[model samples]
Target: MFPGPTIPNRQPHREPWSRERLMYERAIAMGNAIDSTSRYTYGSALNSYLTFVRIHNFPVDPTEETLSFFTVYTSNFIQPRSVASYLSGVCNQLEPWFPNVRAARRSMIVTRTLEGCLRLKSVPVSRKRPLSLDDLQIVLSHFHHNPSHDDLLFISMLLTGFFALMRLGELTFADNPRLRNWRKVSRRSTVTFNDIQYSFHLPSHKADRATSLAEHAVSPTLIQAMGRWSSEAFKIYVRKHPVLLHALLFGADH
Candidate 1:
């Protein structure tokens, strides 16, 4: 009477996921997680690797030797740093299938090969020419007389970005017209004006990936420029697109 009827243990039956199905699901999840720009970069890298593989008839599962060869081959055309980036991109693309593929990029052979190529070929590192004061004056001269809304906006942005030392990404939208994450300069972010100097919070930047907001001082020149833009062009812009109150300070067509 003490023990109740014992139930027989039954194993639940389910169809196992196929390798292709698992890969597809993982890809979907990864695509959702990564930014569009990064995905494009990775895809480009993978394409380069695939092209190399096709030309050389290499296996899908790349060996350290194959990777080293690819690096050296690419180094002949591109800079060593670019070759390294391509290798990293290929590694990232393959990591889902081969977890240890990224390690190949870090191997001694790959490192030594890159170093040797760098020493052998004097590939000058391409650098962006820094904007000079003369350049700024030349640019501003165009908008000196009766500047349009667009001109005013451009002038203000140029000045603010230069003086603030903001990254292009921080100041402007993504290079792709389709993928724009416009950051708004809100009223709350701006501090009280004191003797023509005011501060505003930079919500996010490349270097400061964390949530910490950076405050930058607005020079009198920038303030005046902003005021001029806002008075005429900005007012018209706001009237045209009333919904842009909390949108990008420099609005785009979108």
Candidate 2:
């Protein structure tokens, strides 16, 4: 018999990634780094869904029926937005394992139920009252009379933050303080003179991530309060702990 025609060796074709694809991948990586809080929130929501399934003896596979029931059941205790957040959390957890399961969230029945719940359970929103100048005076007076180095620092932070529109996080460390490499106000950056103005740079803030070096002039009233606290008080406080000169405008004690 004649030998069959020799077949040519073949290799799998590999397509080069487009610029858009490369950029998309890089964007996802950066997004993952920044969404630590969202990850935690979604994880907590998934845990609640799992607990509900275990207790109710529902099927492991999420169906439209299951999601609809869950929305109604959860609505008794939580607002529609919260139930929606929980549903999103559950969907995120399940999508990897059951790629076709997203239909549960998109179901018309589930959507109608969520809308009905929102109408039934809605309440008027309450907002925080803004602080007035008089309110600020009372706070400053209390700290001024106390006259401890800590109290002086507190006064300085209050006055500067009020005028500058600074967030609490920028002015002070979180509850569990640790040194981070992010930009912060330093003593050398501060200019406390007859002018009574503060100048410091922030690498990032809640509103924006762009680097900002700003100087906010202190009001005459605030300047007098700062005098009572004494510039020497701040200098002495930083002297004992040199790190404060670099880490914060109002650094930690001890």
Candidate 3:
């Protein structure tokens, strides 16, 4: 009458994950290693390599000679500096498939081909002139008399960008709504102003370059801190304007 040996209750058994599923997840994680723009650039470079191989009836496997030839071919149309970037893109994208792609890219033949392209096809770099205090004065004079709301806004942005060493994109929203990121946008509440001065919170910025009107007049350390520069790279952006140079030699009062 003891119930003929009681049975133990147990949960149902589950199957272990398949290798394919785990690999697929790992592949997705790997893909996310680079940002969207880099992904696009690397993907384009990979596609270009594939197309070259297909059209030339060459093996899909990358080699020193093939990459060198590719470099020379691309250099014919694009700048040699850009071709170097393309090679970097190719290395990043192809390393997963061809473990030795970087080795091939770094080969003497490939490197020399890129250098030859540079020597043959390089052009002088054209950079837009940096804004100066005189430019700010011009803007100020334009809005001196009875500024409208939009004009005031423009002036505010110009002044902030000039003094804070901020980019225009940091101060305003993109014209295309889709391109706007709320996280990066500064809200009105973040800005505070008084008769003497004004300040605002910057959510994010790509502080690659910066210059200050008070360059030589102030401590380099202070300028670096104000610009939130992480390195001395900011020195490269420090323009040697006549006014700043004069201030360096003479006192600020002079």
For model 3, residues 37-130, the per-residue Cα lDDT tens digits are 5787788888887888889898977899999988898888889899898888889988898999999998899999899999999997776655
Candidate 3 — number of clashing residue pairs?
A: 0
lDDT of each: 0.66, 0.63, 0.75
TM-score to true structure, per model: 0.61, 0.54, 0.70
- Those runs of model 2 whose alpha carbons end farther than 4 Å from true positions after fitting are 1-34, 100-103, 149-161, 168-195, 206-254
| Model 1: worst 10 consecutive residues (lDDT sum) | 206-215
List where candidate 1 sits over 4 angstroms from the true fold: 1-26, 126-142, 175-179, 182-201, 206-254
Candidate 1 vs candidate 3, lDDT winner? 3
Q: What TM value does model 3 have?
A: 0.70
Top-lDDT candidate index: 3
Model 3 regions more than 4 Å off? 1-21, 144-153, 168-189, 192-197, 205-209, 219-254
Q: Give the candidate order by descending TM-score.
A: 3, 1, 2
